[model samples]
Target: MNSLSAANTHFTFDLFQQFKTSKKDDNIFCSPLSISSALAMTYLGAKENTAFEMEMVGALHFNEVTENTEGRTTRDHVEKLGNVHHQFQKLLTELKKPTDANELNIANKLYGEKNYQFLQTSFLYYVESVDFKNAPEESRKKINSWVESQTHEKIKDLLPKNSLEFTTVLVLVNAIYFKGQWDNKFDKRNTVEKEFWLNKDTSKPVQMMKQVNVFKFTSLEDIKAKILEIPYKGKDLSMVLLLPDDVDGLQKLEDQLTAEKLREWTSSQNMHDNYVDLYLPRFKVEETYDLKDTLRALGMVDVFNPQRANLSGMTGTKDLLVSKVIHKSFVEVTEEGTEAASSTAVVVNVGSPPTHPFHCDHPFLFFIRHNKTNSILFLGRVSSP
Candidate 1:
């Protein structure tokens, strides 16, 4: 497969710029890997921008994961991710975008006939010319098991619930395992039962993490926002918090969010010396979503348009179409810090932040990012401190 090249660098950057600008906050991060994936998929006849944008929006579902998942294992999370990807792909395939007569017919046939049905199952399938039918049954089963285990079995069956004859095929499988502890470990003694501010005049009883420390943070008047950087145990990951000055000023921060502005704000974060008392709730969130509709809304109309897509690289016949896209994420928050895992993919990756003594004490938007690439792996908001 061809790699993402410099030829489309500006176009790709522009796409991301538009994506960041459209968001109410700088919540989207794309990794080079994601970019390459989309580019290669597109080169094979997939809609590149649609795939990339869908991945970005797919990240949003993780917010719910951070709240629902308590002690789920990494294996469980991986399967969940696969199922989510399948659904998202389904949505992409079904979207009604502008297309020519032939591509349109192909789109309907590809999705209508359930050619991509393998997506909903556990056996991850790609439309490259290769045969695994004769490759040891044990090998095929192992590949399926690994994909299931890594995605936490969120994806159950892979090779379709039914048998259908397919010609060309390609498959790549990998898994990610993550486990981490809270930074300020909530003191069982200090974990007093208190009311959390859910909205003005509305509160709910919750066990919040309490701490006193110097937190690396910044207050941006220009955007009426505050930023706090919370480091993970390994220091390989950190959460960047964005808090609106006004309790309900999330809109203001959203309006100012942009790729350039986010880059500037993060780059300019300064270490500080000050005492801060923090009270944060302990919560676990988990979420799963089918990303077909979201991708359609992001201007990726062609990939799903079977009649228009030219994935001749994957299938000599213009009969293959992306059928679904699904994503799932998990996160747990407590006094010590947060542990989060997102499965699915994006084109931007956030590199690790510079380590400085900091504590999360208030409401903020935090993003998990890879340190080297400065790409955002995940982005979330804690509404209460």
Candidate 2:
């Protein structure tokens, strides 16, 4: 699971760079965990060139493999498939364990056309038969409703009215909802309006929440930045904020951000428990992304190409190809804690905090990490908030 978490972490950095470059100066947020889970669901049915392409898609899917999944496959192909689904199942199972401190719900479900013969193997998500051919609209509603319910209604209308086509074969959906109270909660009375700098000269008034506490802190002397971790109740998860010493240093920080750098900077050995002044703005960010273009730009071209896709493991034929992937995420940080949920649906588609006088007055990077598993459930940027 740690390897999978690391792989997902690597993917998160790669994806952050893509969004950062494309949506320059705008707030960016997405769940690599959700996206990876959905893709892994789709990968269960991929074979031959498609399987090979996905497996080596720059650490896209793990090598655990899934043998004996539904549908008929050559002995060699089955051997190639292994236990990737089991890995995801394990991940889902582990993350789904009940926790009293946070309202966390994560679910993955595969909705497929009623007639396709699904390849049976380890089930990482609930597999449902839908009438995409006869009732695409109703099917879309059903999927959206399920996603909404899974995320405590935080994520709604995940699949728009026209999202599903009658010809759509398989759609994988992953939704993660988390509401955690800060361990050292801030007092609402301390929140006040303050200037939030979008840039050195440009700024806007924001409701800034202030607090003083001891936290895992580190100073990036080389990059002129500081990192702080504010744990949520139960201490199993923490929100980490990386603030640049210079008011306008986010770009340089982002340009230098990588999995290795993040690991080194946030490692326990580098961070120390220290008392510091902390100020974070009360903010909420919701963004939707049509990841088809992004994924293709990242060299995942063949899966979207019907002519090139070889997902024979699905129905034992090279007929299925991913059409579009849509992801919608919402997050709100207030005095109590944070409320965040993200839904990633494959049309086949398919955090942080501060301390240390660590005032997030300017654009910065943040992520919500599940401390025990070291899995980053969410990664985002607060450009304006």
Candidate 3:
């Protein structure tokens, strides 16, 4: 779980950098967990170089203890990879365990061409085989339906029209839905329109929710930032908010950000209970991304290239390669709490807080994480609202 959390932090930052380059002025939101889970399923079918590339870029840690074999055999490596998937399965099970305090769901599925040769024995624990040959559109609808169901209908049309074709071989997907009420709920009656500083001169009106409460908070004088943890109802999950002292200091914070830095900032020792006067805006963010280029930038090249790709673990032949990776995420933060959903499809076509006067009146970075596992469920930057 530590390694998985670290991997998620690393991937979140990497993906943020990619998105920042293009949509610098827009709010950024994503589910690194969803993306990693979907890819981990795909990684099960990767072999040799393909496997290595994914393990490196995806931050999947594997412990290889070979007793007597010369180095490691293909069978041995595959078995080790299976162990990793099993761990992920366990983690997912824990995440989805029934809880009345919070409504959370995480699901994964796989769709393959009916005629395609897929190894039933090698399939990951969460994969569900679906036929995509006779009617590609119908298969698309079915996959989208599953995503919609998993996300409680917050996510729809995950695989857009004409996205799936007859030539498509495999598709892997992950969907996550979370609805958690704040331990210290803000009063809707107290919410009012307030100024949100986008920059030094630019500002916009936002529906700011006000609250005064004791929360886990910290001040990072070194980075000129303040951090706060807003726990959900179950206390097993939290939204950690990082706000810079200066209105336009987000870029500086980003410049100094890293997985270790995040871990250090979010460490329990650095946080303590403090009374806070919080002003957070009610906002919603919906984002979609095509991650082929981003994955390539992160050195996951072979999986997207048919010529050099090696996903023989799935078909026992080198005829399968990922066609595209599409991700869609939605989040709604209000006075009561938060409702967020996200879906990630590896279309292998083949292939908050804080008060402390911790008023988040300006742009800030935030992450939703499971407290026990430290696994990041979602990450985003609230630049506008």
Reference-based TM-score of each model: 0.56, 0.89, 0.88
Residue 49's lDDT in candidate 3:
85
Which one wins on lDDT?
2
State the lDDT of candidate 3 residue by residue for 184-281, as single tens digits. Answer: 67777778999999999999999998777778889989889999899987788899998999999998887788777888887878899987877788
Evaluate all candidate structures by whole-model CA lDDT and list the values in order: 0.42, 0.79, 0.78
The parts of candidate 1 lying over 4 Å away from their true place are 1-148, 152-177, 182-184, 268-274, 339-364, 382-385
- Indicate the residue-level lDDT of 269 in model 3: 87
Candidate 3 regions exceeding 4 Å error are 57-76, 122-134, 340-355
lDDT of candidate 1 over 1-385, digit per residue (tens)? 0011221222334434444455433334322223323333333232234333333343222112221133243234334344334333432343223222101101101112223323332222442223333443433444446546654553334333222223213333222223444343445566677775545565667786565555566668777777766565544456666766565566567557654566677673453534445555676644333334544554545555656644443444455555444333445666545443322221212443343322233344556544434545445555543
User: What lDDT is reached at residue 61 by model 2?
Assistant: 42
Question: Residue 264 deviation, candidate 2, in Å?
Answer: 0.5
Note each model's CA RMSD in angstroms: 15.5, 7.9, 8.5
- Clash number for every model? 75, 19, 7
